[model samples]
Target: MTAAKKIAASESKARAAEFPAKAGEPAVEVEERSTDGADGTRHVKEFVVLKATWPGRDEADSHKANGAAVANEAIQRGLHPRGEPRFDGAEDHPDGLSLTLTYSVDTVPSSVDHTPGDTTTPRDVLRSEG
Candidate 1:
């Protein structure tokens, strides 16, 4: 299979029947997105958005920064990110955006369902720069 196809296949396997999350569990999605970088290079990535939240309503800068931290930490753990972190427009939460991590194309999620290769505190809402 080609790179894109391989990504799609892996993503489908991860989402087979893990839906309608439990009462308090955050929803997840398998994202296979590509974006062009400032240097003109293209990034092809596939990963899982384990969990997300709108943490900085009315504070655009804070939310984006916080998202960046989470994505960055995920990157350090061998996972890939779509591109530079930014706030995607949302309907339910007008003032904030989602923050999430990612995974390798062939990464099979662990039973624990935590960020891969990470053992540090969560930075999904870290105020300061990492």
Candidate 2:
């Protein structure tokens, strides 16, 4: 069976719970940023980006599958998939397709910065920054 069919809901939830928000971890958020234009005008755009390190193989695989599901759902919603598959560095398994999915959230740079003295801090950052 395919990876999607093989993984059950409980198994996925268990895997996800392993990576809970620690006392000090980046908070993932979705927001829009102003894009500067050549003519000096700006436009707001929304994006999804995330940077997380999985602790083990199972967690990594779980994360990858989760990302693929999101992408596939987006495709179903009419968002065109961009670019060719960059599976060159992906691991191969004897079973079905074995791949990892990495996703990024495109937020305003100011939204992610955690440096001291910054005025705008995300809720997660503020909770842990002190």
Candidate 3:
């Protein structure tokens, strides 16, 4: 299979594994559209966003790697992932434009108490007290 195809497949799998099966929630969605330039040439583009609830550290890291791989493949194919813009050398026209992928991992703040003075900062505290 081609590099693009492999990236797509991997991304799909990652999305599937990241989300739990439940009601009122979707794992991934792909949005695509087409537009026309002044010269009557039609330009097609697509963007993808994957959302999951409370993914673990390992899972989030895996998704990040997969997203980067997909973006790299798109760059190689002369296309951008989405929301990315480029400029061309032509005075009236841009040279190249493509989509770029950005991925982020959401996490909740730790509940464990870590306030200062709650725990001994120095190892000698116990020895001094004893």
What are the Cα lDDT values of the candidates? Answer: 0.35, 0.28, 0.29
RMSD of each: 12.5, 19.2, 20.9
Query: Residue-wise lDDT of candidate 1 within 11-129, one digit each (tens)?
Result: 55654545311212112222222221111111222222222533435455645554555455444433344434444333332223433322222221122346544322234434334
Q: 12-116, model 3: which lDDT tens digit per residue? A: 664464231121112221111112111111122223323332133564453444444433433332222332121211121222242222332111111222342
Residue-wise C-alpha lDDT for candidate 2, range 1-130, written one tens digit per residue: 6777555543444335422122111121111112211111111122222223332456544444444443343233222222211111233333434433333212222323344243222222223312
lDDT of 3 at 83: 26
Of 1 and 3, which scores higher on lDDT?
A: 1
Who is ahead in lDDT, 1 or 2? 1
Instruction: In angstroms, give how far residue 51 of model 2 lies from its true place.
Output: 17
The C-alpha local distance difference test score for the whole of candidate 1 amounts to 0.35
Clashes of 2: 5
**Which segments of candidate 1 are over 4 A away from where they belong?**
1-58, 93-130
Name the regions of candidate 3 deviating beyond 4 angstroms.
1-57, 83-130
Error of 3 at 111 (Å): 50
**What is candidate 2's CA lDDT for residue 35?**
26
> Which TM-score value belongs to model 2?
0.23
- Cα-based lDDT at residue 103, candidate 3: 33
